[model samples]
Structures are given as C-alpha cells and as structure tokens.
Target: MTETALSFELPANLAVEKFIAKLSKKTVIELALQQYSLKTFYDSFDWRLYNANLICEFNQSKNGSSLSLISSLNGKVITSTELDDVPAFASEFKDNVMANKLAMLLEVRALLPLTTVDLQIYKINILNREQKTVARLMIEQYDQLKTRLSIQAIKGYDKAYIRLSALLQDEFSLKTAEKGLLIRALKRQGRKPNDYSSKLNLKLTPEMTAAEAVRVIYKTLLKTIKLNEQGTIEDIDSEFLHDFRVAVRKTRSALSQIKAIFPDEHNAYYKEYFAWLGTITGLTRDMDVYLLSFDDYKASLPESMREDLNPLHEFLLFKQAHAQKELANHLKSKKYLTTLHDWELYLKRFIEKEDLQKNTHISIKELADSRIWKVYQQVLNDGAAINEDSPAELLHDLRKTCKKLRYLMEFFQSLYPPEKIKTLIKALKGFQEVLGNFQDYEVQEISLKQFSEEMMQQGTPSNTFLAMGVLVQGLEERRGKARHDFTGRFNDFKVPLNQKVFKFLFAHKSKGE
Candidate 1:
C-alpha cells in the first residue's frame, strides 16, 4: 500500500529527545535509530535526476550497499536495489527499471558521485489506545548541521494523521522543507544542480565587433577546459577527456574558420598547439569509443565467436591505460600550463587592443555572410565532383570541409532569422552525420588492421586475429552502407528551398540595384 508523506524542517531550538518527550505525554511514541556511513548521491554530470525531481542515493553500512531512487516531490521510493558494487556505467546494470531509466537519461555519460554525507535517521511511530500505529515521523540529520523531518500517514488513517500533525505543529514551529537533504548538503558545500554544461551559451549582439565575438567564444572554451580538468585528473570517466578534446577542437576551429578576426600569426601559433593536443589525446579517445561499443561489436558476430574477442578487449584496455598516462603527464607539464596562460593573455590583449585590424572592425554580419557563402559554394563544388568510384581520400577531404561549414553555421547562427537558420542547420547536420559515419568506419577499419599486425608480432592467438578480421569486415559493410546513403542525404541537404534560404541569408550582392 502507498502512503502520503509530509516533510518539515525541525526548529533549531528543539532537540529530538525533548520533542519525543513532549509527544509521549499525549500518545505513545516509539523511537527507532539508524546510522548510515558513506552515504553518497549520484547523478549525471548535468544533474538529470535533480532536474527531473528525483533523488538517487547510495548507502553503505556494515551489511552492504543499497541504492534508492526516490521522488523528491513526494519522498516516495520509486525503486530500491541491494547492489554488490557500484556500476561504472548505467549499461552495466542487467535488465532492470533503474538501469533502463538511467540508460535513457544518461546516454554516453557515467553516473558520478556528487556529494557524500553521513545520515542519522530517527523513525518515530505514533501509537493509539489500541497500540495501533497511525502516524509516522522520520527525522534525518545530515553531517550534524542539517535536520529534516517527514510525517507520513498510515494507510486508511487520514483523520488520525491530521490530529497528530496538528499537535506536532503546535508543539514545534515547523516549516515546509523546500529541498531534499541531498540538495541541502550540496548547497552547504557551495554547489548547485545543473551547474555545468559543455555547450556554448554566449549571448552575442550584432553590434559586437568580429574580434569581440571571437573573444566571447574563446572565453566559453576556456571555461570548459577549467571545468573538465578535475575529471581528467581523477580519470572518473572517459567523457572528461572526450569533452576536453572537443573543447580544444572548437577552439582550433574558431581560430581557423573565423580567420582574420584574430591576427593570422597568432592564430597559426595556437592552432599548432591545439592540433598537438588533439593528436596526443586521439588514441585514448578512440580506444574509449571502441571499448564503449565493445558489446555491440560482439553482438554482431556469432555467439560462439564472441568469447574469442576477449583478447581484443584486453589489448584496448592496456593501450587506453598507456595513452591516458601519457595524456595526464602532458596535461600536468609546464608546456600545457604555459600554453593556456599565454592563450588567455593573448585574448585579453587582443580584445583590449586599441589599434584593431581591418577585418576585426568589420561588422560580424557582413563577415559571417561572406565566409558562409564562400564555404557553401566550395562545398557544392567539391560534393558535385565526387562519384561512386572516387578515392576514399576524396570523401575524407569533403567531410572535413563539411565540418568547417557546419561549425561556421553554428558559430554565427544567432545573427540570422531563427527559423530559417534552424532549418538550414538541421539539413546540414543530417548530411554531416552520414559523412561522419563513413569517415569513422574507415578509420576504425584501418586502426583494427594496424592493431592486428602489432598483436601478431606480440604472439597473439590466431583466433584473436580471426575475430579482428570479422570486425574489420563488419566495419567495411557499414562503411559501404553509409557511402550508398550519401547521395540521398546530400540531395536532401542541397534542395532548392534550403539553397534559397542560404542565399537569402548569406549570399553576397553586387553594389548595383
């Protein structure tokens, strides 16, 4: 049976024992005490549960560990499970509601411990003349500084609960609790829900100069770098390095794509460093992708063959660990520190510099229009030149070009009509996804072949080589499908309506009427 619970904040002056003594005079009060150690709350990096009005808590005691998924609104436990150990990924859980919900909510992200607090719990039963419990009270004290009270009515005892609540309110001045203990604990430590996001949320106006806009983008990237540093250092999850690499890519893309907004020499200098950053982190991130998709890759093969793929998993783990060590060392090195310091100083200097360059002073709209038009025309020219028999390198080059155009569109999207730009970007993204898959499959196949050769030199089993061959074949088939779908995807993107929207928004016009 389900019960309704009402929560309150205990007054600062009232002790739990004293409150119970006052209540015992009127009715029988039974007290039960429980203590929990190593109580931790878990959430996605973006706080998906807190935003959904859910609280997920992990409690560890002498017996074992247990996880509870509770509704923060009504303090009802949606589910609870006794966990042998905490899972590294949501997908690690076998088919269960908690796993299903978590997988859907935290796709490609791991649950990280947000905060830890010890809980001192008191359960009070209010009994009547017949020694029947009608009302329940739970008082939770977190870390000795925070206290919360919850009053619950037993099934079929609404009127009895009302009288008990009235008496408790009269004895103690109770206030409605607006936040759960987890949230209050987080606030006590100076953190808030949904405090971090990787997306760029800058607000730019048309009047802002090209240089100013570029600085805004750089600052956002800088913040992303600072935010991911802890995760990278601790190796909490693969996403930390993934996000770090992406931020670097965006920074490099901004410098390269938005040319002349910064000095050409300065841009070249930083582009080299960012490119180096990407190169060093590539192996780790690639291994991360392959490991994350390991199960899917195995499922594609016959069940009997899946067991033989274990060696490949071991190799990936070893290489990933080695690559991560290299990355961590580089991140902790003087060069990395100096590069960031120099980059920040350069941005500040450029933004405040009085003698701006010619292109820096140009209105962002004109600049965006000119660049977008040039890139779009280039894409048309290059895409039309490709046929079914073209070399793989041709498609690779075209993919890079598409990425540049897409980034340009995203960076300057706000300067155009919202609906028009949204439609155009949606089309562009669909086309880019096709190209991206094609390129990725090709790269993976090539990497697998290279690894196979290395494993053979290390005296790996022939069965392992056979499994690698199977994976390579699967990737080739996927690549072929992507290639086959490209023409249709491009046609959808390059339709006349989208072309017209592009022209209306960014096409260059002559001086004459």
Candidate 2:
C-alpha cells in the first residue's frame, strides 16, 4: 500500500471544539485523545545530522522509551530501536544497520541533546458509510501551544485523503507548514542551525580601503577565537582547541603578510602576545592529537602486538591530564585575559587623526593583487628548488610558505572571480596535502621516540616500548612514501594551465586600470 502524509499549521484562533464541529459537517468522524509524551531531539554541536536532513529523537511515553532516526523531509521513520536510554557516542548502540550508519556520520563527535518538547496527539478517524476507517487525521499540540494537523492515507482511500485536504485548505484556510518543528522551535529560542563554522566567508568589495578590509577580517577572527575559548578550557572535544589554534595562527599570518596596513610597532606588539598565546595552548592540543590518532598507531603494528600498546596509551592519558590542567590555568590567568582585551581595544581605535601607514589608504583590490602575486611566485620558486637531495628544512619552509599563500588567497578571495580563485585553491590543496602528510609522519615518529624515553623514565612496560618501536618504523616508511609523492604533486600544481590561470586572476594591475 502506498503511503502519503501532509501536515499543516493550525491557526492560534482555531478552537479544538469549533474545528471538530466544523469537520463533522463534511464527513463521519471519531476523535480519540492520547496522553502527552516528551520527545528529546539530539544532534552534533555542528548540526551534522540536521544539515543532512535527518533527525534523531528519543520518545518517552507510558509504555516505554524508544530511539528513532527519522527523515526530516517526509516525516517517515527510517530506523528505530527500543532502548531505555541514549548513548553519548553512536558506537555504544546495539550493533545494527542503523547504528553503523550513525557511527559513519558521527565519527569522534558526541551527540548533544538539543531540546525537548511535550507532544499531545489527537487521533481522528474518517469513516465510510459502513463505519470502516478510510483515512486518518491527527491534531498534534506541542508544549501546549503550537499545533499541527496531519492527514494519513489508508490503502484504497486516496480519494478520502484528497477530499479532506481540500476541505481543510478551501474551508478552514489552513496553510502548509513551511518548516519542520525542530527549525521552528530552535528559532523561537533564538538559536539557528549551521551558525558556527571555522571557515572564512567575508563579503568584500574592490573599492574598500586596505585598512578597512583588514579590520573586518581581524574582527571576525577575534570573534571565532573568543567563541571557542570556553569550550577549549572545558576540554569538551579536540575540535575546540583545534579551531582556537587555527584562529590564532591565522591572526599571526595576517599581521605579518599584510604589510603597511598597520603601524610597525603596533603589529610587533600583538604578534608577540599572540605567539605567547599559541605556545601556552600547544602541549594539550598536541596530546589531544596523539590520543585521537592512537587507534591508527595501533593498527600500524602486527595484530598480535597491537594490544601491547595499551600501556603506552595509559601513559599518554596521564600526561594529557597534566597538560590539560596547565593549559586551563593559563587560560584563566590575568595575562591571557589582559592581552585579548588590549588587542580588541586597539582594533576599535579608528582615529583617522593618528598617523597612517603607506598602504593604509590604497584600494583593497590593489593590495590583494600585489600581495597574492608576490607569494604565488615565492611558492613556485620554493617548490621548484626542492629535490630528492634537498634538506628536510627546505620542505618544511615550503610548507609554511604554502600555508601563507593559502591564507592570503582565502582572505582576499572576494576580489577575484569565484571560479578562478577556487580552481587555484583546489590545485594548491593537492600540493599542500603531500607536504602536510610528510611533516605529520615525521613529527609523529620524533614525538614517539621522545615519549618512549619518558615512558622508560616512568617505569613503563618493556612490551610497550617494543610496540612503539614497530610503530615508528611504520611511520618512517609512510613519511618516505609521502616525500616521494611530493615531486609529482608539485608538478601538477605548476602545470602550464594552472600557471596561466593564476597569472590571469591575480597578476598585478597598472595604475590606470
């Protein structure tokens, strides 16, 4: 049997008795009431499930509690499980198809309770001449205020469903619901989906001055940093510290790369403070990365020896707790608080009466073109000079240069054609990935060696050190492989077509243009 359902918003003025009285004139109807139930909605902090058009809800009724995954588009149940409680992570759920799908989407992220609503349902039956049910209608009131009406079609009763729909629309003047209950409830609470992201999405124009554009970028970055600070202090997840560090790094890069937009002394003062901020937050974040990657480290060893790494995991966790405490203390210190306050106050001072830098009054387009072209050439020069015989420092330097270029392009992407800038960024990404992998593997091996020493000093097990040795060997091999792939990736990045596109999009323009 085919199934179709339609939902409409009930106007506030419509009384339940009056509506039932109006409906009885058109068809034979019977109304039944059910006790109110509570439904708690869940989603990731970033709304990963809701953004994908899926909803996870746990319903609590007199009978029992059940967890369900439903489609937001048609309001149909996709999968469900009868459970007494919801788990923090998807892997804790019973092993089944639904659990597997949830695990794939929510890797390393915890499920958070979004909101709860009281739902009271009224089930109405549309009867035929013989008193058999032909179609089903429901009036649902949420939190004792918001109401919705839904019509469900029974088998071989499509005509009844259509007739009921027309009567509700033509006579009652009820309009279709434009948004789902989750969205409407969130709106009422002054919250929104997809509100927080680490990406840079600035709306810049060519005519704005360089100083004005820089201020705009700085303000956005500052806001992102402040928003993530409490989460980082609480150690909610690794992503909080990861995003916080990214904002700090981006701020430092912008200050150094965007020359002549601010006074030299002012730039130096903030640069020093931000560098200190980066240092204090470094150890705990490093430990977070190591813990997050522990499974991969174990997988690199022989299956028989993988369990031997458990002791090393314990050692790392012990150190992480210490590092976390240190980091939290620093974040709560007066120095950290004062530095951010001073930075914001400095940014707010727009006194045009003060001294101006050389490039402060220039068009933003002019500054973006000149700075981006300069860095793009440096990337080409650095990549071309590296070879099999070159030192690792050269590759590391190239990686930092590539990062600066990527940030510059992102900051001023609005000045260039969207497609062209995106193409260049995409091509550059491949090159950056290889370099990043090479460096990551190298750093992991070195840190593991240091960790092994610390473990020995702390009287860790011998088998754990043996397991780490094997892991280091595997990482070295992978790093070598990534280093070998670097040349081909660089070659693809500097191909004639890519070079032509880069030049056309960002080449410096003459004054008259």
Top of the candidates by lDDT: 2
List the candidate 2 regions with Cα displacement exceeding 4 Å: 1-4, 17-33, 125-133, 351-355, 510-513
lDDT of 1 by residue, 146-231 (tens): 57788888888888889877776776667778777786778888998878876666666778888788788898888888788778
For model 1, the run of ten residues with the poorest summed lDDT: 504-513
Candidate 1: which stretches are off by over 4 Å?
3-5, 26-28, 34-38, 61-64, 91-97, 164-171, 414-420, 504-513
TM-score of each: 0.90, 0.92
Q: State model 2's lDDT.
A: 0.86
Colliding pairs, model 2: none
